[model samples]
Target: MTAGSSPRAVVRRYADVTGHAPVMPEWGLGFWQCKLRYWNQRQVEDVVEGFRRRGIPLDVVVVDFFHWPHMGDYRFEDEFWPDPEGMCERLHAQGVKVMVSVWPQVALSSENYDLMRQNNLLIHAEKGEDIAMMCWEPCTFVDVTNPDARRFVWDLCKRNYADKGVDAFWLDEAEPEYGTYDFDNYRYYAGPNVEVGNIYPLEYNKGFYEGQLEAGREGRIVNLTRCAWAGSQRYGALVWSGDVGSSFQDLKAQITCAIHMGMAGIPWFTTDMGGFHDGDIEDPQFKELFIRWSQFSCFLPVMRNHGNRSLSHPHADDPSLAALDAPHERLLKEEGEFKEVVRAQDGSPRFYSGADNEPWSMGKEVEAILVKYITIRNKMRPYLRELFDQAHKDGDPIVRGLFYEFPQDHRAARLSDEYMFGPDILVAPVVQAGARSREVYLPGGEETIWENLSDGQIYHGGAWQTVEAPLDVIPLFARQGKDQGLRKAIQEASA
Candidate 1:
């Protein structure tokens, strides 16, 4: 917390193979699951070739939960993947990096479980027993708060980073919870064992961040986790809201919830782009949700197309939603549902409340709105980079509410979903129903320039702009003279 503290070094005391700070300039895209078989030597070549063909800036490809054949047995599938080292090396050659997901609970039947269990490397309750598995495994959670446990996880990473040439690891399902087990007297390494809801994920990622620093390398090291804790930011970890269902309200809440997380020090966060819960590859609603958010996600820090990827295409067979926004996107045979206006094929249709509040099944208008916002994001990469730098150096978010930046404007506090990415831009996304237009409150003295991302319309500062924001466009504004206000106000103020 001091001026001289090495954020990286303080973090390194906990993990296995510490490396350097992230230095990569390009942003990345992630997915919810990864397929092990299709990721073999020859298969990876085809995958890399596919990305090159799409011309997508596919820098980091995530190999999520699917990579693990079973719990604790963490090794490449030799029969299916004869050469993982070769696959990674080839992906790197194609300018694409590999990221594998790792869970904290080592499976009881895993090849590596005995090594950890016998050494007491897993998390134990305060009563001093190994933490029981809740969701993903039959093993206990690792006590990340412990030194030995930290080293154990890091050692695994070292083998991956140095031996297999994996670019990064996505720390997944670290949300430590207990099932049907009642006693709150759970164990921890040394700290007081508390009924911590989701702290393990944070510790899991923190351990990895430390390991990355010790390796003396500086590239964007990401921890795409399902859970997190305070100070997890220092570890370069990002959290997506979790596996949610495909209800329209969930989508609306995601926007506001993410804003809240950003204000709480997690500027780099998003949710299941398309809802994540139980729909199959053929769900029409799911398809539309994917396209709409995939377009919206283009503007976010990390882009990922997750959920049930085993299907050949996500409702691409349905050409129903292709009226307004299908003009520029890569509409595959399975990806066309998001291009037009249509009704949801399933789910509680009542969730589609209004213009911005409607689900993808509402129509093409919403999809168009998302597409327009994405175009703006692509154009503002330079500015996004500026905010990312602030996040790295000073914990500033790429997006934030107006009050955090302009606390003096007491009125700024009310705009929860509407926030500024830094000192320059203001984003007031629509998150309610039955509303064709919305109200925007501006700071009294600050100058703003609203360059509509959907259309190139520019609105001047000093007043609220009652602009028409069809479902396709969120109200976005840039402060015209943000720096000048500070300089002028400080004419006589000094540090």
Candidate 2:
């Protein structure tokens, strides 16, 4: 319970107690393209090519979960990802970095499972069948709580992934997302799950952070993680809201969550810019939701687009998937068309990939809007870099609630729908479906002037103004005499 004269001051004091987030790499500040799964090497490359071909600025492309032969393989399946080093090199040549998904689950069939079990490097089930989760297979988590276990996993990752030119990792399922939240059944090197479960994510991130540092990588390391704890920011963890449903309500919830996460001392926060589940590419409603979400995401610490689209099935009988036939037969023989445990002979789950979630996949109109916001995000890179610096040095949030910048204004404290992007820009996102115009409060006295970024109008602070928000526009105002470059970016985006 630290208090200061202002919210920023309180944040600084809180950060001093919990530790500040790492200075994010410039690439991490740019737009990241991802989906539920980029199933193979060609698909990942194709998506990057698609972005480049359209002149969209993409900084990172993620290889989501189940790219390997099995859970806990810590390496890509050669059958699917034949030339890891070459693929990374090609992506690097195109100026896009690769982030591979890594889950904590180690299935019973994993090559290293026996070794890990012998060394007690896997999380132990104190009772029952020793399986921690049963999503695709009966599996146990690597005991990231133990120093030795952390080192063991990191060593495999360094040898297999780093050596193959992977730039960063998507540390998925960091909460060790159990099949059931049966905390008492699990035990870690640190303690029983009920006693020490909260620390799991922190240690999960710490292992990679420390391992990267030991390998002589500095300053540029950032890992996308699903969960985080008190000091996870110090370990270069960029936390995103996990597995969120696609809805207007979820979008509204993200605003509050971002503010709360920053106040909790984790300055780096992002959400899947179109939500993670049930967003259909062809549906007009989803397109509207995605457009609004993309606008909001442009102001976030990291701008990312990801989701699993409805009716976009990977096994839709396309000839391109012909290579998967033999594997599918083997999987069916093993699991008998029970899609839940769709595994390869090597025990890796052959999960179905979602529909194409690229910006262009969402029809031309939505594509244009998404590209516009992505361009705006690209132009704000300098401003974002500074915000990240402040977060690293002084623990300021990149996405600030109205109260964070205007502590004395009681009305500002109550505005959750609108927020500040750093100290300069005030963003009032269109949160409701089919709402064309909404009221915005420009806090501060008459001396404070606000420049309406949308139509280049002017307003005095401490006044409520109704702003028109078409499908293409988000209400933006740059604080007069502050971040003039932000206004320039907005102009450039429109241009």
lDDT of 1 at 263: 51
lDDT per residue (tens digit) for residues 264-325 in model 1: 56657766556665433444555555554554454456655454332334354545335324
Consecutive 10-residue window with the lowest summed lDDT within model 2: 330-339
- Ten residues in sequence with the least summed lDDT for candidate 1: 348-357
Across 254-273, the per-residue lDDT of candidate 2 in tens digits comes to 99989888988899999998
- For all predicted structures, in order, the TM-scores are 0.71, 0.93
For each of the candidates, the C-alpha root-mean-square deviation to the true structure, in angstroms, is 10.9, 3.5
Q: Pick the candidate with the highest TM-score.
A: 2
